[model samples]
Target: MKRFVGLISGGKDSFYTIELLKQKEYNLVALVYIKSTDIDSYMYQTVGHEMIPFYRQVLDVPIYIIETNRKAINTDKEYVHTLNDEVEVIYDHLYELQKKAVFECVSVGAIKSYYQYNRIKSVCDRLNLSVLTPLFNLDQRVIYDAIIECMDVVIVKVACTNLGKEIVGKNLNVISGMRVDNWCGEGGEYETAVLDAPFFKKKLRIKNYEVLHHPEEEDKERTVFFMKINEIEVLEK
Candidate 1:
């Protein structure tokens, strides 16, 4: 079996990519997570990332957590090698891991963001590792339907006016009936975290949490909501 390193962000798309790769007989040997200092990073997800450690227990795999300042020093359509860029930070971490263990490829879950996809591909190209993106360019509605049907996902963050604090901590299924800019949250409409999935050994239950609202400074009509997970428990599936 070909060994692959899975990039996890504690989000629906990244986690779902692991499930897709496993189905194709890829060996998920290790997981990599980037802890960005910037909460609003264009290249990474920072909301609800504090819960990422629990995923190691759920997936039964070793995880490597790296920290980045989340700087977009190189924002060009084609990425260039720069030490300060967030993408280079990812490359540096993966490069070091490759020396310790030889993995054939890396897995990603980019749906429609060519900017993200291209940057990741650039890193893998330099490392001589193949990039596997199972969810690339797929229809958002189709992906949303599949995710809700197979996994237990929760809304962790809302950045659009159409959604508010009331939507926080709710199941992803609830948003299906409501009108939104993107079904899969691809347009930054919202963000999600997986509580349970078929590949997980256990499920997460949020015992206590607080919803925080941050109104946009320039746009009074828009506000961002986040579900701060104060307490969580692991349960048998």
Candidate 2:
């Protein structure tokens, strides 16, 4: 079995990728997370990131949380190694982790975003680590259904006009009836957080939270809904 490091964004896709990796018989050695300071990062998920550390307790793996200023210096389809780009920061962190841990592959959950997949692939290439994207080209609807069926996920953010703050903090099933282009939020229509999953030793419980609405500056008609979780707790299953 190949030892691999999984990337988690506190979202369903990334965490679910770990489940797929397990199914493939990969030895998950560690977890890496990029905590973006900017919520609107072009390359990473930023919502519900505050609760990421709790995943260590649920999965029983060492997690490395790296902070990025969220500066997407390189936006081209093909990535080039650069010092100032956020991707370089990821490469640097992984490079440091390699010295302490032995992992040959980096697992990602990029379903449709080539920009994300490409950048991560570029970094892994430089580190001599293979990239494992289990959900790279799978059907979004099927993935969405599987996640809803096997995981306890909540809508933590919404940016589309069709969605509102009412959906925040609610289970993912709430949006199943609604019409949306990307069922798995591939196009950034919304964001989710996984509270419980089949492989988790413990589940997360949101103890308290408040809804926040931020209207888009470019388009005043559109508002982004966010669930600001003030408190969260981990419970035995």
Candidate 2 lDDT tens digits, 52-167: 88887898789888987858887889888877887887898889999999999999899999999999999998899999998999999999999998999999999888888789
lDDT of 1 by residue, 87-145 (tens): 98889999999988879999988999888999999999999999999999999999999
Candidate 1 — which pairs collide?
Answer: none
TM-score of each: 0.95, 0.96
**Model 1's TM-score against the true structure:** 0.95
For every model shown, the clashing-pair count is 0, 0
